[model samples]
Target: MKTSMAKQKKSKSLLRREWVKSMVQNRYLYLLMLPAIIYLVMISYRAMYGILLAFKDYNPKLGIMGSEWIGLKHFKNMFTDPYFRHVLLNTILISFGRIIFTFPFAIIIAIAFNELKQRHLKKTLQTIYTFPHFLSWVIVSGVIFNFLDYTGPVNSMVAAFGGERKVFLGDKKLITPILYITDIWKESGWKSIIYLAAITGINSELYEAAELDGAGRWGKIWHVTLPCIRGTILVMLTMRVGQVLNAGFDQIFNMSNTVVQSTIDILDTYVYRITFQQTPDFSYSTAVGLFKSVIGFTMVILVNKLSKKMEGTGILD
Candidate 1:
């Protein structure tokens, strides 16, 4: 007992000393972060109270606290709905497709940009690429419509080739792929910026040393370049997996019509349709959103755990 007590005392002393040292060294930094800490407490933590609606028959008239509880009814309704399956599938398919295609392209663009010796040309190209990221889905929709409508440039070109005018946007078979392709074209360049920053941070001496030892461009990239940026890639991938259920709601909603809604309807649109257009049940929508949040939060924990086991450095640690 005495030995154990002594060890405990020593540990307490060490912790207290470290805490004091940290407080002295970083008190100003902590003070600077105070506003952000308070903001998170007010916004993030306070907003969590809205989740109580998921368990209640929330009405604007009755208000949140006075609402009658009807636990799990909304969830049960969701499970029984036939359209839920389609929405769930669309969400997963679109999110996964983006992850698979977009990530590698970002990495490749970053690597290629790092290879360019002309600074002016490289900056100009990057600026051009980044321009599309600023365009909202509404603007993007207008641009897409102009090219895809019956009498648009595409149809004119097709007519010149002796082909019939095609309604690309309205076609169920084409809409999902077009959504994915257009999304990639719009966002990939901007997304590559972070990866390019990571690539630029890699030590030039490593590449020079490899070249000195007779390594080619491909050889250096395979060995040095990829390994250096793998951590950033892993973190980005884990974040994507955490959000695998959210598949560009604004983009989908703007681009989709009745013709392609079956193929492109996702959880957000489903919730919006149920809450606003059909049932107008605030509680049901809250329940659905809460369920989505739970699933996403759980997925982040599970994926982060697996990533820690595989890669040693997961998202958090």
Candidate 2:
């Protein structure tokens, strides 16, 4: 036991020495990382202390640390709330809807861009497709309202064609589809940039070898392009899974109205409403936020495990 203890201490000392040596050798690289490390420490890690509010009866007179402990009272109330259940279901539905409909468009667009032979046309199309991503949700919501309003050009065209004009935004059945469509339009092209980059990094020799084997464009893409970028796709998918509960707060908040409130009320908006629109309940809101974070984290872990099982690689790995 004495000899083992001495060896362990020696190993630790050696490790410390090696770490100091490496840090000194990479001083410039560490300097470049200092700002990011500081930001994470200050903005991200420091803010984690507020998570305690979920377990406290937060009072204005007493700050977070001084708040009275209420140990799971808010969590119990949250679990029992019928409205919360509805909101959670809505959040899950919307999140999965995006995964099903919006996720693949980026990959498809990236592949399509890769297949394009005309450089000028590709650049122009890419610019047009990606331009929407820069626009704030407020602007996009306003444009959507203008286009879909009863007296707008879309309705006029419907009237011209002898079809009855409809309230697209206010209709519950239409609202979710509209959200999916608009989300795809606004974000897919920008998301495609990462996939395009992955495609660009694929070895050229693999394609040449594929062609030598008499493989066509579609064949090369199937066997070479996709397989080469599978790891990147899995990594992005794992990250997206981590945000499964988000459900696009900015877009929904901007586009939502009283008529469509029940259909589109998600967790973030519910927290906002309870905290700001209604009587302030900081502890309850914090509990809801904590719940969301837990679920998102769980989803990320599950997806990462599945990714590793299927692809022999994972985001965590």
Candidate 3:
């Protein structure tokens, strides 16, 4: 009994010491972080109460809290609605396609840029490549429209070859592909920055050692360079999974017309159309939005957990 008491006393003392140390080291940092913590709690976490509207027959005068609750009504409507099903499928397909295609291209750009021996040319190329990313999708849509118009440069080229000018924007078969390719082109170069930073952080000594072992360019890339940056790639993939539902809202909103709306309508645009145009069912739109957010949150958690289980590190850490 005496020995047990002594062990308990020792544990209490260790806890006290740790508490004191934590107080000294982290007290100021905690104070500094307080404002941001509170701001997030207020703006992000607090706004979650509006989710209650998802269950309500919300009215502007009644407000969210005063609204009449009808649980699962909106959710049932969503599943049964054929248009919602199509948009949901399109959203998932487009988002996943972008994640798979864009990540590899970013890594390839980083690796290729890393090997450039000429400083001026490399910098120039980097600047040029990144330029398109800053252009708004509205601008991009205008550019595409001009190029694909009947009398535009692309159509003119086709005409010179004795081929007919095609209306690309109105073509349902080509709309989704056009969106994906344009997104890749506009964003891939800018996205390479993170991967390039990871590549540059790799130890130069490893490259030297590989060269001494007669490892050629491809050998160094496959064995040394890629392995060093695998952690960054995994983290990127995890973050991308979290953004799987948020596939380029501005791009789709600006580019979509009545002609191809059915093919490219994502969850976000669908919500917008339902709330503002077709029917002013704010509660129903909120319910659909809430569903998308829940799915995205689940995807992030699952992906992060699987990543940790496989490699022992995740994006959160």
Candidate 4:
């Protein structure tokens, strides 16, 4: 025991010395990271104080700390409200829809990009595909409107093709598909970037070995490339599970109209509506937001457990 204690103390001392030396040597690197660190502390960490408002009956006059404690009244009300179930259902459906459709599409795109023989062609396609991700949702919505509006190009095309013009944008049945397809268009290309980078990190020797073993391109991708990048894919999926409640405020805000509101309204839009458009029930909104966050946190834990059971590798681990 004495010897083990002495060894532990020596190891800790060495760690402290190395930490000091690394800090002195990497001062410039730390300087580059300072702004991001400050923003996280100020904007993200500091804003966590508002979560307490979920448990309180907030009053602008009484302020945050001065408000009366209401326990789980807001949370109970949120769950019992008439539209709560529909909103919850919408959030779940949209979240899983993106995962099921968009996730595999990204992998396919990454593989397609990697298979390109011409350097110039690959670079051009990459840029073209990734450009839409940078455009704000508002801009993307306008572009969609041009295509899907009653008298828009799509409707004009239908008219020319001897079909009746349709209300594509306002159709309840079409709203979910439109949202999914447009999001896939804007994000799938960018999402593939990480997978592409993971593929790049794989050693060339594996491909060469697979080739020697008579594995074709698709065979190599299935047997070697995919196995190597499974870790990244698993991590991304686990993170995605945590965000099941967060069905993109910007896109939903821009795309939703009264006609499809019942089908498309989610936790985020519900929070926004109750906070600003309605009575500005700060407490209720905060409760709804908190409920979403708590579920998100729980989701990460559950997914991590499921991943470990299925893959023998938990994302958190």
Best by lDDT: 2
TM-score of each: 0.83, 0.85, 0.85, 0.83
> What's every prediction's RMSD, in angstroms?
4.2, 3.2, 3.9, 4.7
Model 3 agreement with the true structure over 1-317: per-residue lDDT tens digits: 99999999999999999999998999999999999999999998889989999999999999999999999999999999998999999898989888876668889999999988999999999998899899998898898889888899988999999998888878899887888788878888999999999999999999999999999999999999999999888888878878889977899999889999888899999989988999699899999999999998998888889789867987667
Residue-wise lDDT of candidate 4 within 1-317, one digit each (tens)? 99999999999999999999999999999999999999999999878988889999998999889999999999899878979878999999998998887778888899888888999999999999999999999999999988888888989999999999998778999889888999999999999999999999999999999999999999999999899989889878878977899887899899899999888899999989988998798998999988898899899899989888867888788
Candidate 3 residue 91 Cα shift, in angstroms, is 0.9
For every model shown, the clashing-pair count is 0, 0, 0, 0
- Poorest lDDT segment (10 consecutive residues) of candidate 1: 100-109
lDDT of 2 by residue, 1-317 (tens): 99999999999999999999999999999999999999999999888879999999999899999999999999899889999999999999999999999999999999999999999999999999999999999999999999999999999999999999999999999999999999999999999999999999998999999999999989999999999988888888878877899999999999999999889999999999899998999989999999999998898889888888877877787
With a 3 Å backbone cut-off (N, CA, C), the pairs that clash in candidate 4 are: none
Q: Which pairs clash in the backbone of model 3? A: none
* Lowest-sum lDDT 10-residue window in model 4: 308-317
Say which prediction, candidate 1 or candidate 2, comes out ahead on TM-score: 2
| Per-residue lDDT value at 174 in model 3 | 83
lDDT by residue for model 1 (212-310), tens: 989998989998999999888888888888889889898998998988888888999998898889968888889889988999999999889978976
What C-alpha lDDT do the candidate models reach, one value each?
0.88, 0.94, 0.90, 0.90
Model 1, residue pairs in steric clash: none
